[model samples]
Target chain A: MTINAEDLHKVAHLARLSIEPEATERYTQALSSILSLVDEMQAVPTDGVQPMAHPMDATQRLRIDEVTETNQRETLQRLAPATEKGLYLVPRVVE
Target chain B: MQWEAVIGLEVHVQLATQSKIFSGSSIAFGAEPNTQANVIDLGMPGVLPVLNEKAVEMAIKFGLAVHAEIPERSVFERKNYFYPDLPKGYQTSQMAEPIVGLGYLDIPLEDGGIKRVRIHHAHLEEDAGKSLHEDFHGMTGVDLNRAGTPLLEIVSEPDMNSAREAVAYLKAIHAIVTYLGISDGNMAEGSLRCDANVSVRPKGQEKLGTRCEIKNVNSFRFVEKAINHEIQRQIELIEDGGRVIQQTRLYDPDLDETRAMRSKEEANDYRYFPCPDLLPVELDEAYIQHLKETLPELPEQKRQRFTEQLGLSAYDAGVLSSSRALAEYFDRVVELSGDAKLAANWVTGELSAQLNREGIEIEQAPVAPEQLAGLLKRLQDDTINGKAAKQVFAALWAGEGHTADEIIEAKGLKQVTDTGAIEAVIDEVLAANPAQVEQYRAAEPEKRGKMVGFFVGQVMKASKGTANPQAVNQLLAKKLEG
Candidate 1:
């Protein structure tokens, strides 16, 4: 499948990446070639083989159900751009 | 010209594990804003997600409870999306292979029949944080405490035909999870939530219509109302020559209307790929078997046992077995009273009515199971008739007495079953109402059937409503008829 400028713009918007109009064509071509490579990879025949989810076939490492973390609101809120009343504040998100 | 609604439900059940699914942070609700959020939950750099074993066990328990296929291996994938509440840009969720696969639940419908709702799959995922829109000036406050909390997203096949069926399906799921003790199943506290996919088609159409998903309906009542509103909206849209558009809609409970939250085109593609950080979850046969053996008697089995073995009606069984606490309470009542029918009635009728009026759960009832059983026992042994039993129940609810016998003794509410006392009252009633007695004797037997009730009432009134009604009827029949 070929990626168009409009599709690229939609993706960029969804990722919250503001792409300049002049750079749209270049990014589209680059991303489209990457997608084409993926298309070519998908075209390879591998009928009976199971799809690989991870690099190695292994089970998940289990952890005991315990509360090991303490309150770190002050420590974590130090990185926020804006905070008030122990909350990370952002521009209002309606819906 | 007839439109039929097709409905399916996706339920998000928050697991009751102590910590978040991927992090060791506390998953307890109502913690101060960011207190429960750790570095892992806040998506700090270099932090990896370690799976919680209890969460996986809970998910397996649910799969076993539903008799679903537990895959030998399940993989977690990153569902890419962007929102302020999601600290990480992508959420770790199972997509291609979920833990529970291809199960069905038999939900008891109102018409004394069970409707089997087919399950598509149930996957485990993490919840996003809350975006509090209030109490901030032009800014949203984010509480990351809920972030990384484990959630089991149960998807159902589009088998429901009405709002009633959808609600039944939700209730059944709620009962199952709560019974398993995996989740508290409290909708108001956001432990359990539902999203409904609804569409409409012509009455006999085999092909499905365009469906709109109503998202995050928290309450069962709201779910029913939202589906009804959406069905009406879709039918009207189709009837007016406007095609239904597939989109995500939000149910506005206040307005009782579903509004478009986002169109299909604006929705995210959610580029899903297996998470490299976490390994595939492989379950051995022994582990799955252990979970199956450890599973509790589920709602359907309990309901069937109540109906068939205990001889309770289907409705009573359904009501009693709707929640684990209620079923346990009913069982304790039956065990103590040794009367299954009476226990069923008292639990479903009097106790339920009191609980509803007080707006409390069965666990918070002022009257304990033994207390209720005591009252029921009084009713059974003719110690108190139904009316006196109700009075004793009211007294128990008001904290007037600890046991049924206490209230019965204190309020003089026990039935007077002594033949001599009843005969004296009957004689007084007969002598006081000479004209009525003469009329009863002169009246035909057919008319006397209706007339005899007056004497029974008078007898009961003379005895201050403590006389046994059947004994009163028998005595009145012997005296007035002969």
Candidate 2:
């Protein structure tokens, strides 16, 4: 589960984060320590126990299906880095 | 030397819920960009997602319709990816335990046989928003109105061996969702879409070949063509001594070919983990039972009823029961006319023809079911012959009259069943064509049967197509013989 520098750069790229070259080694070590902690949990044996998704074992609270949203495009689009024709604009995405 | 294509479909059905799956934002289509997006949909800080109960109900209905296992507990996980359309850096989806468990759908094939496509599972997820590339001056425009829309992604086992079976399976899913009232199942509106995983292996090989997925095929025809194109591409690649690479491909419907979008090596590893913001969905026995009881008669059950109880052919039953609206229309017609076969014929034949011609759906038909049944009733009672019934139908379709009797009466198209009146028309037709009559009398008996149709036509023409054809045939036979 430990991430090396090369894999960390790839992960950072996938996350669309640009990490400085000096910070790559620091990130790799920090992420690998987190993985080591998760690895410690993996070593514990609880074969029959179900995997826990939430700490409190609470069921999902349901909401009735209703349209409570109002038009806020003008307000939201203003927060974007760029916008045109009421849409949030970004660099061209081909696929 | 023969290659067989193995196809599996992953269909994303937008649940017909009013709001987004986890947010209270509207899921209505055709909204202005980002108008329907609320704070939660926009991935603002401190916003939490609460699952929509209606969406869960819809997923349960689909699971039950396909005879799938509905687990009491399902967890929502974060599928992490980076796309501008996904304002949330990750999508909320079911990864480990989906709401719907294993199930199988028995799709009726074109050759009157059924093929059972095993379901791998179905998971509930929120949809990503749209990215408008056109008219953006080389930049991309993002619309978040579709973001966080509820979706039920149904995945199938690789059981379909041909394009035809894949299309049938897709169609069956379409019909089921539409019948369940869970989704509109409109491909044009993208309420229903499919991604096909295709591979080719040598015939009788136990191991499957490398699979490539064709993404976001919107229509059933395109699904078929895309799969065929992908299969051919794989087969050709293998035949040329090149191994097929696993990749995600896009089907260019305009080009009718599939091109690689990205290789599998570059595919995103959606680091999935349970979302701590949303709790696990736990269903009680009572809730599941209530959903089961409220379920409507599914397509297969209705098709069976039409065939066994109503004495309809399998094909006719399939056609009539394909959609709930159509089946209801047929049922109303049958109830009014008390003739299942006639109702089946008219519903599938003339009504369908006219609807196709006018480019309208059955729900938008100009003629109502009762009016059509009224026309069929006249034909049954000899108030109007078939030809006159057709004329009445045309008039009804044109909105000339509201009732079949009104149209028939206005056009004077009632069948001439009176013995005396028909006898006069027959006599006049015989006298008007004496030379033909003499020729008929002098002809052989076998020839007389053929010649009798000419007289019947002449008599019908004289009667303005209102004469009962069977009665005209019998009377014409006796008179021409004498």
Best by TM-score: 2
The DockQ values of the predictions, listed in order, are 0.81, 0.81
Chain A TM-score relative to the true structure, per candidate = 0.89, 0.82
- lDDT tens readout by residue for model 1, A7-95: 99888987889999999989999999999999999999999999998887567889999999999888788889999988899999876
Model 2, span B61-83: residue lDDT tens: 99999999999999999998878
* Least well predicted 10-residue stretch by lDDT in candidate 2 chain B: B262-271
Q: Provide the interface RMSD of candidate 2 in angstroms, 1 decimal place.
A: 1.2
Off by over 4 Å in 2: none
Candidate 1, residue B273: lDDT: 94
Q: Across residues A48-79, which tens digit of lDDT does each residue of candidate 2 receive?
A: 99999999957889999987778877777777
lDDT by residue (tens digit), candidate 1, B226-344: 99999999999999999998889999999999999855555558989999999999899999898888888899999999999999989889988999999999999899999999888
The fnat of each candidate, in order, is: 0.92, 0.93
Model 2: reference contacts kept, as a fraction: 0.93
